[model samples]
Target: MKPRIIMNFALIITLYSALTFYIGWNGWIWLHTAFGLQDKWIFGVILELISFSYIIGHFLKGIPFFKVIGAYWFGLLQYAILFLPLANLIALVLIYLNLPTTTIVKWVGAFVLAAFIVLFLYGSFNAYSPVVRKYSLAIPKNAGKLTKLRIAMASDMHFGRLSGISHARRLVREVNALKPDLILMPGDIIDDDPEPFIQKNFGDVMKDLSAPLGVFGVLGNHEYYGGGIPRYLTEMNRIGITILLDQVTNIADSFYLVGRKDKTDRDRMPIEDLLMNTEINLPIIMMDHQPAELKQAEKNHVDLLLSGHTHRGQMAPNHLITKRMFEVDWGYLKKNQLHTIVSSGFGFWGPPLRIGSRSEIIQIDVTFV
Candidate 1:
């Protein structure tokens, strides 16, 4: 077999084994220990089947039914992550209280399942219905010709089987209602799948979206992962979005908007080179997919930087990981007169759920000082 195939198979097996082990731990406590079922094989088989379904769904994502099943599996994984530690803690407490093993298992099992349900429901609602997060910046008076500019920005929409055309339409409507002067999308607008948009012609819905300064965007890593950057760019342009790939433009002569290609692109232009020979007096707004190389942005004197690759960890427990990885994983940060806004995301990537972070479209109101 080819080396690539061998590597892929190894990766899949490793992931499947890991998930099975995690789910099996929960199963042991809830099934045999709690309900007095002695058939370990049955529980083991159930976990194996669940993991198999999840693994298969990735290969068959083009099929809508499989995608739905895959979404459920992903959601199960997240819920398990949320409850496993709590269940373990409950088990310890019960043992300390001198409760019978069966009683302890039963109560802890029930508690864990109930908590999972509540959390899942709350997370689902939070993910599907995004709120508008607002921020204001006082710009230096000499920075621009405009006095006040309202900009609505969102990133990491990740529209696919889970977050489909309806989600896109809702985002457009909500953003339009805000009546921002300019609409900005940092990156990851598509979730590595161009088929859904192609089949549904979701771009038509996007045509309804309007902004006087025009809707401009930069590429996110997903755009490349989803396949056919040229095709995706064509579609985006058709829907009235001007994608800026290492390009700069003056929005109605008010300020400069520089759209940088995603960091994931190895051949992407350097920030310093992009700024060279450019007017520095105007307020410079940059749309970079990932919030890395902060010093570069500061060194370039970028007035504002917007991004959304982190998704603020997308779910609980993992949100903590993202927080630690990025200087400003979510929300707004101002340093050395340069402002950065990293959105959690306009939509989610998997499970159709959000635990620790919020799904938001940020509205940044800038008033020249």
Candidate 2:
């Protein structure tokens, strides 16, 4: 592992461990005082077990049954991590006012547990079910002979324990239901673990996706993090999904579609280089993963840019991070002739949950003026 990766993992593990410990301590106190539960140590052990399972799950992707169990546990851990803080804060407020903490603790504990249960349950279903987010863009009058084009696009379908063949089938079904002339995937198709995809035979279902103009995709950060670019490329190719790494193609005799590799590539080609040989007069629709470098795309006279990676914060308060990080984190942004659409993503990366953002597929109705 790279030093940076090792350091990041160490930092995450340390922080997660601290949070787990805090929640367990507070929870035990609540159980002991409010409900007279004598098994505080047992509860602590259970929390430890859950944490361990999550930590090891990252390494157990190749394992069969353990991976599934670990994944579910990891999902639970994600919810707990978020809920515990709020629960603890509530207890703190009661104590701060010098009120009766024991009674309040019970109410807080019960409320936290119930709320998390509902949140995770809803999030699971939500993550599995993606809604179509449609947009309409007009091609400049100077470009293209094609009058109208229907493009169905999605991104961040992190296929693994949380999202596998079943989720893949649903997305493919929805995309096909749209009867689009073209299909585009911005990136993060595979999660960090590619083993689960192999175990689930996800490609078999994905192969059924129908787009007459063909399905094309760019590389996402996860594609490199997942550690199997060639394997993913081969699998996508087997399913007839074209993986375009900083390449441009003209389709439908009307527009140019350009796909760029994720910024993870240290030597990634620039937009200028990718479009250098292409006909600039045609309407160019670019699919780049992170949504950075808009000026470059605009400079190259890119008519439309489709991207996904942010997941629009995926959870509350996190959206604040993405909003500040990217120039166009979510939704549509147009500057003169250059247009951009960034999807919150069709699937999730972790927790199998979305607290603030909705998973979405972009149904773009492009009219060549």
TM-scores for all candidates: the values are: 0.89, 0.89
Best by TM-score: 2
Candidate 2: residue 220 Cα off by (Å):
0.8
Report clash pairs, candidate 1. Answer: none
Kindly list the per-residue Cα lDDT of model 1 for residues 1-369, writing each as its tens digit: 999999999998898688669778777857876667887888787767666674566677655766666667777876776678778887888898898878888887887778878988998888988999999998674644588889999898888677889899999999999999999999888877777776777888878889988998889998888776888888998888999999989776777899999988998999999888667788889999999867799899888999989988877788778888899999888888789999999888867888887789999999887
Regions more than 4 Å wrong, model 2: 1-14, 34-36, 64-102, 141-145
Residue range 149-232, candidate 2, lDDT tens digits: 899999999987777677898988999999999999999998865666766899898888898899999999999997889888
Q: Residue 265 in candidate 2 has what lDDT?
A: 91
Deviation (Å) of 341 in candidate 2: 0.4
